[model samples]
Target: MVNVAKAQDETTAAEANTGVAIFAGGCFWCVESDFDHVEGVRETVSGYIGGKSDNPTYKTHTANGDREAVRIVYDPSVVSYDALLRAFFRTVDPTDDGGQFCDRGHSYTTAVYALNEAQAALAEAAKADAAKVLDQPIATEVVSAPTFWPAEEYHQDFHAKNPIRYRYYRNGCGRDKQVEALWGDQARDGIGKK
Candidate 1:
C-alpha cells in the first residue's frame, strides 16, 4: 500500500528540504521547456523511465521499451506538488493514449511517476481533476516511480543550448497547438509565464 504522506517523520536532508517529481509528457524537450517557465522549479532533467533496460539512451531507450520523461526538482515551499501536477496536465494531452501531438509511439506516452505514497495520491487526485475538467477519460498513468536514468549531456538543457532547433521541433510537432486545443484558457494556467 502507498503511504500517502509527503514525508516520513525522519527524512534525508534533500527530501526534507525539497521535492522531486517525474513526469513523462511525450517529448522531453517540450516538457523540459514547459517547466522552465514555472516559478519554483529549480531543475528539469530529460530522462527515460518505465523500461527493462539496465542502461537506456536516446538511441536505444525506445527499443528498450522506455518512455521519455523529465525529473523536476523544485522548492516545495514556493510551489506545491499539486500545482506542478496541475501544470503538467495542462501542458500535455492526457487523453491521447497513443502519444502526444506529432509523436506517436509507446515511448511518447504520458505518465506520472510518484516517488512516494503522498506523490501517488496527489497524482491520482490531479489526474481525476483533469479528467473532470476535460469530461473525458484520461489515459495518463499515475504509478510508482522507477529507476530514473538521466539522459546524456547533449539532451540535458537542450532547449537553452539549442533554442532555435528546440522551437522548430516543438512548433513543427504541433504540441502547443494541441495543448491549447485541449486545455483552452487553462492550457498553461500554472505556468508563471505565457
Candidate 2:
C-alpha cells in the first residue's frame, strides 16, 4: 500500500521549493490547457481518480467509466489555491454536477478532490461561497482524494500537443459557450467579480 502522508509530504515539499499545486479539474485537456495560460502553473498531468481502478487509461476513462481528470502541479506561493479555484469556477459550470461539457457520465462529473483535511475544508468553503453567489444550491462534491492513476502519456498536455484538434473539439463541444451562458459575465470577471 502507498503511504498517502508520505506522498503528500513529498508533493508539498516539491511545491514549497518549486511552487507546485496538484489539481484535478474535470477534463484534463481543458484543465491543463486553461492553466497553461495562468502565469504561475508549472505543470499539469491528465489522469483518473475517485474510482476503484488500477492503472486507468484515457480510453478506459473516456470510453468506459473512468473520470477524465488532470493533475495540475503549480506553485501556491505564486498562485494560491484560491486562484486555482477561481480559474476552476470560471472554466467549468459547477452547478451541473453532471459530467463536464460534451462528456456525459459519472466519470466526467465536476468534483474537487482534496489531498488533506485543510484542502478539503477549503474546497467545501469554496463550494459554499459559490452557493451564496449563485442562486442555487451547490452540487459540486468535495471528497477525499483517491489514488491518481496517470493517464496514457499521449493524453498529457493534449491541447498543446494537438492545438488544431484541441480547438476543434473544445469549440465543437460548446463548453466555453455553455460557461458563458451559465456564469454570464461572471465567467469573464471571475467568481465574485459581479
* TM-score for each candidate, following the candidate numbering: 0.92, 0.84
Question: What lDDT tens digits, residue by residue, belong to model 1 across residues 12-55?
Answer: 32455788888999999888988989998888889998788877
RMSD of 2: 4.1
Tens digits of lDDT, candidate 2, 16-66: 545433455566788778877776677777778765557767656655455
**In lDDT terms, how accurate is model 2?**
0.69
Highest lDDT, which number? Answer: 1
Cα RMSD to native, each candidate? 3.1, 4.1
- Candidate 2: deviation at residue 72, Å? 1.3
lDDT, model 2, position 173: 88
Whole-model lDDT for model 1 versus the true structure?
A: 0.87
Q: Over 4 Å off in model 1, which ranges?
A: 1-16
* Candidate 2: regions farther than 4 A off: 1-24, 62-65, 188-194
- CA shift at 93, candidate 1, in angstroms? 0.2
